[model samples]
Target: MEINILAFGIAKDIFGASKVTIQLSDAATIAELKASLEERYPKLKQLASYMVAVNNEYAESNLVITERDEVAIIPPVSGG
Candidate 1:
């Protein structure tokens, strides 16, 4: 299956684009997606932490990703 991810902040810089496309096995979980992203973008692993949101909701590790789902890569945010 193919998924389109929306990146923000450092995530966009690491990916070199605001959006990235990735291939994954059918019924892949969020954890698997993270692993795939880490494999392709090593810099992501260096981040303090990140989260995957599906359909506007924070996804769990076990959350299954479907092609129809809207996926976003949310990097950490800091504010004074």
Candidate 2:
């Protein structure tokens, strides 16, 4: 399955684009997607932390992801 991901903040820089598409096995979990991303973009592993949102809501590691789902990467944010 091909998953389209929207990147924000540092995540966009790490991916070198605001949006990216990746291929994954059917019914892959958020954890799997994270691993795949870190593998493709090593800089992702250097982040303090990041979150995955599915369909506008934060998603858990075990949450199953489908091709039709709306996915986004929310990088760590620091504000004064």
Residues 1-80 of candidate 1 have per-residue lDDT tens digits of 99999999999999999999999999999999999999999999999999999999999999999999999999997857
Give model 2's TM-score versus the native structure: 0.95
- Cα lDDT tens digits, model 2, 21-40, are 99999999999999999999
Per-candidate alpha-carbon RMSD to the true structure: 1.0, 1.2
Residue 64 lDDT in candidate 1: 96
Q: Candidate 2 deviates by what RMSD?
A: 1.2
Clash totals for all candidate models: 0, 0
Model 1: how far residue 17 lies from native, Å = 0.4
TM-score of each: 0.96, 0.95
The superposed Cα distance between candidate 1 and the true structure at residue 1, in angstroms, equals 0.6
